[model samples]
Target: MFTLKIITANGNEVIHAAQDPIFHQASNTITFQGYDNLSNSVTLGEGLTSAGGDVAYLMGASGATLATWRYRQPVQCGSSLQPMDC
Candidate 1:
């Protein structure tokens, strides 16, 4: 199963949203599709830095294009979002 959570706040008020816990097994590395989108991307990394902020480490495989990650500045998780690039 896969679970994802997103929390948001307006002013001092806050709200919580989470998905069911989804599980996966990765012996060496893990790969999945549709993660380029925001909603499905929640299950990709260990933690969220800030919206769009990411740090990816790819192992040696074959093609250079096969081992790449997309990392922006602001990452989104819970209610806190920050600009990791700045």
Candidate 2:
């Protein structure tokens, strides 16, 4: 099963919020979807990354990984929600 939990807090480290792990789908590289939304889908048989922030993970589900969306970040920063555009 997929589980995603986001944790947002203030700058003073007082408003702490618990978070959960997520995944990334890579074809050959273990990185985030910087400009590719298609590489961010939390589906089965996909690649993932968790190198920074220590807030995410990539794990197969039932050996098939087909569940709810656990983690997702916008590929396009100031543009449309496309799969290959940033």
Q: How many clashes would you count in candidate 1?
A: 12
Clashing pairs in 2: none
Query: How badly does each model clash, as a count of residue pairs?
Result: 12, 0
What digit string (tens of lDDT, one per residue) describes model 2 on residues 23-84?
34222113333222333422322224442122223334344433333223436646565333
Compute the lDDT of residue 9 as modeled in candidate 2: 20
TM-score of 1: 0.18
lDDT computed for candidate 1: 0.29
Model 2 vs. true fold: TM: 0.18
Judge candidate 2 at residue 54 and give its lDDT.
20
lDDT of 1 by residue, 1-86 (tens): 12122221111221112222222222112233333332332323333433432233333223122233333335554565643332
